[model samples]
Target: MTDPMQDPGFLQDPYPTYAAMRSRCPVQPVSTGSGGHISYLVTGYAEARQALGDARLSKDTAAFFAGKESRRRLHPAVAHTMLATDPPQHTRLRKLVTKAFTTGAVAELRPFITQVTDELLDQWPVGEPFDLVARLAVPLPVIVICELLGVPEGDRPDVRRWSAELFAAGKPDVIDTASHSLADYMTGLITAKRLDPGGSLLDRLIAARDGDDHLSEEELVSLAVLLLVAGHETTTNFLGNAALALLQRPAELDHLRKNPDEVPAALDELLRFDSPVSTATFRFTTEAVTLGDTDIPAGVPVLVALGAANRDPERFPSPDLLDVDRDAAAHLSFGHGIHRCVGAPLAKAEAEISLRAVLARFPGIRLATPPDRLDWRRTRLVRGLASLPVLT
Candidate 1:
């Protein structure tokens, strides 16, 4: 069968395809669009959980891309970031920045998040249709991340633009250009922090590099770039997806509106219903491993379908239905194992705060157009909408 992934309808709503794939077998091989490389896609809940934390599965990209053409297309800084490396290298890099991104550290930003939410809400046009994605979802995170990194306010729009371009999967050249541009911008920012440090996270990272030699210049640049890009990009999509899910299910939206305390639970259910990240980043096997009943050879690439795993019938009953009261905290939307997202707490806080504020301010909000007509982003990695027009 032709890969359903190549179809536009599938990209817009892949749950049906994932359901069929999961029913056939938990693990199956599929060809990656790039280089015709075969990668095992693990869709079952149990298999995905095991594969995520499996030490034999390597995050090293070099092992998967040995050809000159493959090597030429990727930037070393991007290929060397914490996400692309295994411990103890990944351990060291993660530790250097983990302190600043801890749950406690991120929780400290609640006031700031609320403030940003309030300010953005105040700008919405009264009784008119507007794009929530462009106005709220995108800027909220971009502003928060930039402020955390000590990036000046004026430069945030560029950061958001570059981040979006990096996710333009249909255009490899555009992705490459965005990657190089973002890397260069971070390189310059790191250099500036080194000369005159502030109290921000970037300053602390510079201290680690200059003080203990814990981080090299290349690693510094790469880490900053990763934080900046992933920091905003993930939460942006999360907010958009969460809002879209709620608006489509007015009953669930009303339930949350009535029981405001259940906002956190709603976030979890929404996350499982429509994960912002469809699949965890690439994982290559270091040695031959058996996942479920399938034997995957060493050096082969593996992709854990987080979105699919969350919907696995064995894990959650009536997986297609959104039950706000259901305990969906175990969902792998933020991923699992040592590579789990460090900024998850912040993302959750942002979503909860933003959603509550939007609901409170716009009680009559509804989809301006039919749900099926909404344009979803045509990307495999990040599943989200191109725009979310709503009547406020």
Candidate 2:
């Protein structure tokens, strides 16, 4: 009878609710608030992973939204990118876009990421309390993504604003307005890239063709916008979530500082400990799918709660505990299968460099307030602190 998705308590601490749900069944029908829509929520680790990679659970947004009243008002560019399509189109888009996030390409950005992390860390006054989310977490990814995409420095502020508004939970009007604004901005930037190519990734995307198949004008715009949106928010939330978790468990933070080389490996544990992406994006059953003995009808909506799967006791022993040394590489924080996050390498690099730099820069940094008093973001998709006030 509990509305696990929308309840205020679940937003603060969903782990208990997830445990309760998983105790009964991995997949269960739950009312998803208005319009009397019942969605199949996947909470078990094995089942969640199974559901994510199953082609039966389609990612086609138009198909998923049909005959349903959705509060999300997304632009075509925002709604119909690689994240919201099936094979063929999705494969082509993923192939073209994966060029920017290759291993060598992301490795090349470490110096810049470290430099930016240090520069941002330097802004914090010694022995003074400051909001880490605003000062570091939020701006780092925005700046990094903009620099990669050739966005003007002056225009980044507006880009940040628009990107944030895209997640305006209940305000469909605000979400739609932000969606168009961001799409329009990207459209103009793409036109500019065509006229005058630059050294950034955006320039390459504009000119590159995939086996005589270049992105159509719409696909190009959508891909560009997708890169920006995808590159920005998730990393921002991950950074914030990772930092907060480390601060709470000083032992784990010390482990990274002492063994800096292991920071990269330790990132997966942090990602699993407090997953940033609460749930994977919208997916509906293309045909009847059976997950963990639960039978889902064709065309029914399904949700994979990444946060729950990461913390499931079956997949991870002592799931609630934060152990940096644990091999948490298999976590579904970046998703799985063909739809695995294209920017996973870049995101991992960002977290590693940022964590190493920040920990090194501010050794004495600690939370400015009690852990319980910290403000967590009250949204379904992203799980992060609104503002992590810390003292240097």
Candidate 3:
């Protein structure tokens, strides 16, 4: 009967609740409060991984709601994106987008990422308290993604605003507004790219060809919208959470400062220690599936709690502790299986550059206010601080 999404305390620090659930009801039913919608929450590491990779669990909302009353509730633009599709559709959409984030492409972006990180740090108010979320975490990814996608600098603020509003839980109207507005903007942007290709990824997507198969107009807009939303938001949260994690553990912070070479490894531990994505997107069972001791009926929605799985004792020793030296590469932060995040490489590069720059710039930086006084975002989909006030 417990609803973690409705509990402010759970939203602030869900680890305790996740630990309790993993030990007690590993696959428990809970309500998300979206028009009385309910879902089975998978908390244990094995169960979560199994559920995520299960082919019986459908990602297409339209397939689940084919003739249901909720069929019309979702816009085509929102429901038909690569994230919401499986198999052939997801394959096609992802193929067009994957090359841009391949190792080579992402490597090319390091210089740009470093330049932007340094530029943002240079603008940071020195010797005075400043909100790291606003000054550093928020702008770095936004700038990088915008530049990568060939989006005009002037339009990024609106994209950021709309993306933030879309993820705001309980604001269905705001979500709807942002969804349609961003879709429209992406549609126009794709059109602009078509007319005058900027040689950016967006242009590549527009020109992508595979054996006479090309992205349809709707697919192009949806893919653009997806990249815009996912590319920046995850990295923004990762950077903010990484900074907060390091700041809270002084010895670990000093260890990392002394061993600057370990920043790359530290990023993996930071991601596992406090995942930015609390849960995977919605998945529904196409047939009865037993997860742990719980029976999940066909057509029932399931959410894989990434935060819980990352800290599950069976998967991680001293699950709650942040050990930068741990071989944390196997963590499920970027997720596992087919739907794993495509832009993870870019996110890691951005975080590594940003974290190193921040530490080097402010060797004596520490939280300006007590840790407990900091505000965490209330949204259930993403875990991040609203503001991280720090002083050097």
Candidate 4:
């Protein structure tokens, strides 16, 4: 009955609101300030998974915006990426990049990830306070992604700036400027790769474009930008949020420290408890569909509340408690069905390595400030902390 968005407790901790929604209305209607109305917020575990995998719920924004005034507002490149596609096109694009994210690829990068983590940790000043979010969380992922993509190390700072701007581009003015700037930058990179192909993902994509004719230049640039942004930003939030959660809940941190084997399981629980990406990317209905008791008509814009679904009491016992050993994989943190995240393995590895390394190295790590004093990101899409000052 309560508006989850306007609830203060929901803003701080949404588990209560999630439980209420799951019981009262699995599919409830809500409005967006843009004058569009979303017919339902799918909060239950099974239903959220079903909707994510369903073909009837389209990821293609163009289909939803077709013949609508909003069609003219979206950037063309945004609609072309794999995130906005469904079926054969999504499958095709995913195949072109799947090898880069396979378990073997991530396994090979473990040593490199460890090295990066150690190098950053080695630089941390002793005794005094330091901001973990900026010094470590932000740069580690950016550096790893740059290396993976063969992006020049010297260009990392600029790349990070561009990535942050792109993530913050939810505003109209910011979106327009950031989109144009990123497009121009990517165009130059793609051109260089075409001339001097090398061993990076971008180079592989260029080779694919030239040899197989399966990929286009525009698509290559779009994919490159997507990898750069998604690869770094989401992981940054994951590591940052997980660290903050552990600091807030010392018992869970101790449990992880004692049972090093539970790192993977703990990571899953952390994701479920406080997801990095609070909402699904975006979905538009292909045709009028019935979800629970709600009838969502075609062309309606819908965003799945992944954070809410993860804490649904009906799905997991004691969903609000942080249980490191719980079978938390059922949580929709990586989503489900066809639209499941392709970079999940890599992200999981990164989180496990990062958390383990931090706990091992800084056993005395604790929040330098009170939990409530810590700043959180204002956006609903990416749940992150502004800064996490910790004492090693």
Candidate 5:
């Protein structure tokens, strides 16, 4: 089973494996490739939902690695992010940046998002196959998130590169290098924001850093790095998976193209079918915990298999089928409880607008290569294709 994860069959189609795993106990230890750490993977819908919000399972990577030289390569800014910490620290950090991603704020960006989608689609080479990942999925979100965060357009290529490298799963040194580089880059930008506070989201964050209720310098840099990376990475992969899902099912793709209004609602089902986030960030057990009737010892890591939970037959009938009309709202793609993804609203808006536009602009779009030939990224956490070549 350990070697199967690296197998091409498992990489292209893990859903069958997930179904087999779920048929056993929903929560059990598996070879999650956590660098020899004995990790438990939660696959049942109820178990995953419970573990996501379980207070006994901590996210404090900083405290866990304290006085231990094992993780010395991890920068402070990358280590202490909201994603890796439990409340009240997670609460304080989430509150400071929550305003920028509120529903109303995301609503205001709809027009801009559509404009960007149209602009990106405008340059498509006529009647030729192009790598959708390179031409559209990757750039659309990079442009939107960069503008939202006030990242200078010139530095975006570097930011994109560093962000991609940050997810190098097994390469510790590469991950360490990217984390430090991004942190140092953000530190300089934050200092500049202090002198000239333009009205970007980063400017607002800087104002909060200096205001009465302040964020520590490390927290500021950490939060900036988190937003810069997750703000678009998740959405980029989501779009790639979504497009692939639709291309495989011509009926479903046409159903939405005829009724574009349904595109927004369909995102939930699309996400459920093939979640971009294969597993939610791992949680460490503060004390002994029981999930899905399985007892786990204290000081162990728990990985919630979001992709499996979303496809649980018990949770959603015929989970393998993508029914756009189904109420797939409960899927764990964006996670659950307090640590749920904060940028979900923005990601959804960006995905819906971009997906709909892609369908409209190129109704004849089809995969240029065989589905089995597509390669998936090597990263363990993010589930996405290496490239999506399509003919327009």
Candidate 6:
């Protein structure tokens, strides 16, 4: 078997490697410096879904390590968020977020989302080439998250900069520094919110904290930073990746244009065809668990390949092909069961509105550079282009 990371072809198009892995070794041993030598990387659809939802596979790395000396070596702050925890803590954290994602909640934000999309399109310079990532993908989510989190409009630029630093891919030192910076910033923001409560997610969280004894000041700040960063970064990748998919497949773009009603379905296909999140949030086995034929022992870190599982041919025929009409709702792009993304609905709504607005405004939009020449994020868990150049 080949190292997926070393293969440029695999980096550009991982489905082939995923297909091979799924067939040959659904449960493969993978090594990560943080978790040490571990049997990880679950590829098959059923196995991936089961692993994501399985109670036996603990999301809490701290609890998994307990009194072990190795545990202290890892970054405790990054590994202690909702993404890294199980119920009832996960459940409690998710509840505070779920309110912001209710159907009524998202519907109310639709007009705002549309407005943001239109404003971005209106500002795009015509004729000369521009980086869609800078103009649209990055700004759209940044603005939305700022509004949602009650981050003052003045601080958006700094917030975005901090988020980029925190999520800097593959760079351990940068990640560590960024994590501390974000924590410090959020601590200050939470303090401000406490002094002057405004009607925003932060204010709501502060109010909710007053009622629930479980949510500490530190936890609230940590979760706020998590939501703000994850909320924007993941969706930025989705918008960029979805646009790339449509530009690559003009027919699909045309199909979407003709049937605006297909936006929801197409979004699902876009997610599965080129999922924003390349891998699941890391999970460690609580005990020896058998996935397919491989045996993974306790304390091993596992990454469920959401991207790979979404492209499994056994689940979706011609899985590699982007078919807007395909029933892609079953894809694990938002993940499965307990740890599924809480902001999926909002993310989907934002993507649909943003994509439609971009295509409608810039009908001639296409990749300005060869797809092969496009750079990708190196250290981040997201699978996305570094910049998507386009001629509007």
TM-score of 5: 0.97
Model 5 spans > 4 angstroms off: 1-4, 32-35
Top-scoring candidate (lDDT): 5
Clashing pairs in 6: 169-379, 169-380, 170-379
Clashes of 1: 0
What tens digits encode model 4's per-residue C-alpha lDDT throughout 1-392? Answer: 33466666555666677777778877777765455554467887777877887789988876766676652333456546789888888888888899999999999999999999899999988899999999888988888888988888887887778667665623666655666666667778888777887899888888888787579777888888888888888888899889988888899898888878789878888899888888888887888887766778876766688988888777878878888878888888888887788888888988888888888888898889988778776565677777899998
Q: Mind giving the per-residue lDDT tens digits that candidate 1 earns over 1-392?
A: 33557766787789888999989998989887755768899889999999999999998876666663652354567766789988888988888888877779988999999999999999998777899999899999999999999998888888889889887877888888888888888888888877888999888888888887568888888888899988988899999999988898889899888888889877888899899998898888989999999999998889888899999999999999988888999999998899999988889999999999988888888988888888887777888888999988
The better candidate by TM-score, 1 or 4, is 1
Task: For candidate 3, write residues 1-392 as lDDT tens digits.
Answer: 55776666786689998898788878899876656677899888889888888888889976877777642344578767799898978887887889889879999999999999889888888789999999999999999999999999999999999989878877777888888889989888887776777888788777763235566778877888889889999999999999988899989999988888899988888999899999898789999999988999998999899999999989899999988888888888898888999999999999999898877878999999998888988787789888999998
Give the TM-score of each candidate.
0.97, 0.96, 0.97, 0.94, 0.97, 0.95
Candidate 2 lands at a TM-score of 0.96
Reference-based lDDT, each prediction: 0.87, 0.87, 0.86, 0.80, 0.89, 0.82
Candidate 4 has an lDDT of: 0.80
Which residue runs of candidate 4 sit more than 4 Å off their true CA positions?
1-11, 71-74
Tell me how candidate 2 scores on lDDT: 0.87
Q: Which of candidates 2 and 5 is the stronger one according to lDDT? A: 5
| Worst 10 contiguous positions by lDDT, candidate 5 | 1-10
Q: Cα lDDT of model 1 overall? A: 0.87
Residue-by-residue lDDT tens digits, candidate 6, 72-167: 222345558888888988888888888898878989999999999898888888888899999989999999988999888888898888778765
